[model samples]
Target: MKIMNILQIHNLKPQFPCTFRTFPHHSLSGSLNFSLRKSTRLSSSSFLLLLVTPIRPTFKIFTVSRIEAPFFENNKEEEEEDEERNSATNLTEFEDLAPDGVVYQNTLRLVECSMFAAVTGLVYFLSNSLSIENYFGCFFSLPIVISSLRWGVAGGRKTMVATAMLLFVLSGPVKALTYLLTHGLVGFTMGSLWRMGANWGLSIFLCTIARATGAVGYVLTSSFLIRENILALITINIHASLTFIFAAAGINTVPSMNFIYSLFGILVVLNSGFFVFLLHLLYSVFLTRLGMKDSLRLPRWLEKAL
Candidate 1:
């Protein structure tokens, strides 16, 4: 019985030890699992937060001390001084023109005006003095065209006025009026058209129209006033001149006043075209020689030839 009891006691002791060992083992495992789960949850939450929130760089704000303010003030003053110097040196184109330069340009304009006026007066006198055809009167355009190209419409008008005054002084009012209507009007028309930068074709067309209108009016008025065959004589003379030229070219053709009158419109266009072409050539030469800028443009074909 004692041996049995001892065996029983030993078995109970071993059971208690085993129970204690199992309980401790299970508790340690549970604690380890709980800690691992907590760590996993914390790591996932931290990763999600990092993904959701964007990280931005921090900038430092600096305040200038009172001691550095004077230095900055000096720098600003220096910058302003440099700006003033640049402004003083870099002037606008018009402002950069010196007083002497202004005076010189004005003087040159006056000289040109005087010269052109004289030329116009001389041409007028020559046209009136000569008993030949009215072709000599066309020379009056020289000054008007030059003035227009050099100084624009205002200059042309001034020149026209000066020429008219000179004509009035040189010849009687009647002669002056005649010259103004017949020649001066054409010059003014051309100059105005040129000053406006009209295209070559349009300029020629307008000038031709003006010339034709003026010529017809002058002829009809003069015929009515004089009670003579002035138109017939003028047409006959023109026909004779053309016939002579055609004969010289080995084409003998006698032209009549009726035929000439019938073709007067066509003749005017051709004649104006020829005269304007010549005037353009003169203008090109004059502008180039004088180193003046002109906006006048000729036809592409005419440009090539000129």
Candidate 2:
């Protein structure tokens, strides 16, 4: 039995020589020579058998840990879209949404209007209480200008009416009428021109003309009330001043009253122009302090001079 087992093992070893050839030798040249010799020794039947045999694929086994995340999602595009939607929704959630009609409902604007009316009334009161000259009454128009600038020509008219009513109650109809003839007319004329987007020069020119007309009307009204010609009085004063000047200069000629009157008219016009410029300076300063932008900016040289 032992001799038969040995004989079988020896025959089996020669039958599968390609099984040893499957592993490469240490030397590449030796391995190549062995492969060539093995191929030459193999019969056509053995080569056919080797070709028909199936190869078994080998795999390596490894230990890998599986980690789990609670909020992680598998759809990458959906995750990106969700992030974008969350950001956009957060941005639009707390926007301010105010109504358009709220402009008329502002109590602060009403308060500002009342304050302007009171200021104008106070100026009237001072003019009356102090018995200041009628020319000093020009200062009363400042509040009206401010009101007009703040709220437009309509607001200015309201301020004028309010001021007149206040003055009427305090100093009677005569004082109120005087104010209307002087400051009130100038205020309304300037405010209307300004509100209509007129240039500073044109607006000032119109205001000066309106004021001059008001002065003429006031003079006529005063003359009618006092039974005296105010223009004749003014002409007399001008004639006296010219006679004094000419006497000092050693001139014998006495100019005609018409010449004196014409000179007085020219001086009045020039004075009105000066007043317009003065009012413009006041307007610029007040508008700047009130944080309002002026439609007509002061020239650089004028601003520096002021």
Candidate 3:
């Protein structure tokens, strides 16, 4: 029995020792390999999450910022329209306040009218016979009447007085005096008539009557006096009155005896009458457009004082 027990103990020791060594080696190697694989997987996943997270947040922030930026909605056409409207308003205001422009225009018109009257008067005196009756001096009166209506009676009178003085200096005293008597008186009368509210037709009729009366007076005076100078003067007066009558009838017929004389007389009356009517209407319309209640207003000083 002792022999059998010894053999069994020896065999068990060899087998058990070899099995324990092999088991320790296999367990340690397996556990180390599994730990390394798990660590590698976890590191890769962390890197991918860090990259994706930052990129998504940056993209979202850029989109949101762009949406919040301000933008204008007005088109180019609308802006241009607004500018045009503003410019029109400014121009209207300038025109309304342009008193200097009005005064300058009035001064220029007066100068032109005066110059025309002086030239026409000289031509008339040179072309006609020196007799007062033949001269039909009323031709020079129309410009003065027109000037008075457009600029006022004061301006008209100033031009007429200057023209009369110029004529006296250029021509002999007799011719100058005759011109003043006929033209100056006619101008003054027409101006007065216009101021008293005479329309175009009435003003023309009154002027015609005045001319006819003057002619008749001259004829009667010369016939009674029986003087050669007076006779010549009366003949001139009758010719002038006839010329005016023809002009009023709108007959453009020229006098065969004196073409220049008849033509000039007709032109003077027609031009003057037409210009006076046109300028008066223009003045009235301009004043009305500027919000004036009446063309004949009080003087500046009087208005201010009141």
Candidate 4:
């Protein structure tokens, strides 16, 4: 019984063939070969036993763990839309400027308009405080011109109103009223007409009419505020001038009321025409320097002269 137990435990001569399959790899392919040793001696119930031994080195086993693969979603269209949204927004007013060298985005426009209006008021205030020449700083209309060139007629009108409001607060309602009627309206009309791509001929014509209207409006506002007749003063000045001219020529003839009114109207139109022309010459160069090529399409002769 002891010998039989040893033989069964050892099993040196197996009834079936033995094979050890290796893990799948390029270097290791075949199965393992094992040599078994028979068990020895039953000496008074003591037993020695052995099973199998491999001659060559065995390959190591690798345990694989279960893992889930992640899912992938495509959002190419949404990503493209996000990129397009970022394209229009800029960090600064000059950054990502449009072809006319201005950014027309409403949020940016509002900020710039407010700043320019403040500048306009400040310049006017300083000029008055310093008791400078009345004809000085006519270019304070820069705000209105820039607004019209950058954001169109609506922007110019907005700038004028904002500047007028600022001036009303800083100075008085009369100063504000005078500004809006004269230089403010002139800048708005001239800038808007130039930006519209109108030629010098049409632009000058339209702006002259606008300037003349503004002059009339200014006189009316001044007369109403001062509670005096400004038209009477202008007529008196005109009558004195004609009288002096006639006395020098030894021709004594009284100028009629119709003639006086006609002369005043003519003088106003002529002054408006010259003022508008001067603005054209100045802003053509000014806007050109600011990178707006089409702000005013100067004539060939004028362009060459400039």
Candidate 5:
């Protein structure tokens, strides 16, 4: 009976599964007390049994005193210092910005993106509704380019989505998609290349390809949406031009479907090339004036021309 009482009091089972690592730098201090009373009626066999019986292992449960977390006050001060530093170093331009371990820069990015999106949507709507496509069309993609040049790929992507959504709500899916493919895609592709410091030749070449792809996509999408054969119309116009040239040259040859398509593709590629070159030319001078001289690496000839 004494052994049972001692076992219960000492908790000779694995009741507390706590480990030392769980209480880091904690102080543990506890004492154990065991007492047994001698009984006059106890037989010799009972005493012998108590001596012979093995005692199970006991666990000493300590009262762990947790030290106040180290540097707890210092941590709050450090965090405050970081916020102050970030605020102090806040910049107007996010180009090549270093991570500040804070959300301030991201908040600035969101504001810039919203401003660009609003400008793009408003300009696009006005240009279309005013029926002055010829003049306003030249700058349809400027906001995208500026956003990309200032804030890079993510900024450009957000601006594009916002502009497209706004256009869809105001105009329709056709206009929105057209804007996305041609104008938005051009701005995104060229601006990303320029921001990465890509040279003029490579940037122009890749952007030309992107612009051509967007044109083809726009043509097919618009044709399907409007239930008209845009390609067929272009083929007819190309054939008419070819017939006039052939007649002037006294050549009695009619262009085949393959030949006509090839000519059409060439025209589209040339148009895309010109558009990309125009962007490079315009931005090389414009960005330089904006105190972003390093944004583009202009060739000598282009620099002289500009």
Candidate 6:
């Protein structure tokens, strides 16, 4: 009996220890009821814990992933900034490499020269009086000379040679020979005039002096030695004066004698000035439309060429 009693006392002592750990003696009945309810909940939770999967190990992985997310965002931002910088650099490089205005100007000049030459050729072919005398009969030589002054010796020489060749081809052998001699003289004189470090005005003046000398020579030669044609003197004088006037003003020099000749020369100068002005205007408008800078640096080759 005493042994059974001692066993009962041992069980009661374990309950006392559990009650003391959870609640004091002064705890309310409700608190005791809550403690009993908590014990029941703990017992059920332990059973559930045995059946459920563990979650503690994955907590470290979740924390690391969360921390790395900001780095990825920073990396993306860095990439975007780098791209922007590269784009700006590329744009700057392009601007430095390519110049639009100079290219356009050169192209336009070539086209204008070609068109003028073609028109002159067609006019000569249709006139039926296409002889070396007639082909050169117009002040066309003046434009050739002036083009050199404007574009420089190389361009001028190129234009003059091209014009002479075209005339030769169109006028046949007799006219070609005469035209070549006359034009060759003009080219040599103009080239020499430009090469002498003369300004535009002086170049034109030199051309005038050359023409005047030629005219005087023609008169002396034709009147004294070659009496076959008296008209050659008149032709030579008219060509000289007309060429000087035509070159002084930028325009097509053509063979014509009268009061109208002066008016035509004035008209041609005005027209060419207008054409150049319009080209500049168009260039400005194009640049504005493209959002480009107003002033551009000249190309090195073009600066040297000019």
Report lDDT per candidate.
Answer: 0.68, 0.72, 0.57, 0.77, 0.79, 0.49
In the order shown, what is each candidate's alpha-carbon RMSD?
17.8, 14.4, 21.4, 11.9, 20.2, 18.9
lDDT of 4 by residue, 133-235 (tens): 2666568677898898888888988999999999999999988887877778788877787678788898888888988998898898889888999989999
By lDDT: ranked, best first: 5, 4, 2, 1, 3, 6
Clashing pairs in 1: none
Query: Which ten residues in a row are the worst by lDDT in model 3?
Result: 14-23
Model 6 misplaced regions, further than 4 Å = 1-63, 66-100, 123-138, 168-178, 191-306
- Candidate with the greatest TM-score versus the true structure: 5
In candidate 3, which residue ranges exceed 4 Å CA deviation? 1-106, 129-138, 200-209, 216-306
Q: Model 3, range 1-306, lDDT digits (tens) per residue? A: 564477576753222211111112233233222212222222333444544763311111223445553475467668899999999988876765576566557667767767856875676567555555444443566566666766667767776777767777777665565565556666666766766666556766566555544444544454665655654564477667777888999987645536544654565466555544554454444444555425333335434543
The deviation in Å at residue 34 for candidate 4 is 53
TM-score of each: 0.51, 0.59, 0.35, 0.64, 0.65, 0.35
TM-score-wise, the better of 1 and 2 is 2
Q: Residue 300 in candidate 2 has what lDDT?
A: 75
- Stretches of model 2 off by over 4 angstroms after superposition: 1-114, 132-139, 294-297, 300-306
Show how many residue pairs clash in every candidate, following the order shown.
0, 0, 4, 0, 0, 1
Residues 1-306, candidate 6: write the lDDT tens digits. 674478577753222222212333333232331243324223333444544944322111223334344445877888999999999998776765454556555766576556545554445445547345454344444444445544556556666566556767887644444433444345445544544554444544444544444444444554665556554545566677877888889867665666444544455445434433342234334433555322322234433543
Order the candidates by TM-score, highest first: 5, 4, 2, 1, 3, 6
Instruction: List model 1 lDDT by residue over 11-65, tens digit each.
Output: 7422211111111223322332111222222233344565688644334445776
lDDT of 5 by residue, 1-306 (tens): 786677679876323232111112323333233434343234334556656986543455677898887756888999999998887667523433645534667878899889888888888888889987778776777777778888888888899999999999999887899898888888888878877888888998998999999999998997998899998999998899998999899999988888999989998999999978887787677777888776667788866776
Model 3: which residue pairs collide?
133-236, 133-237, 134-236, 134-237
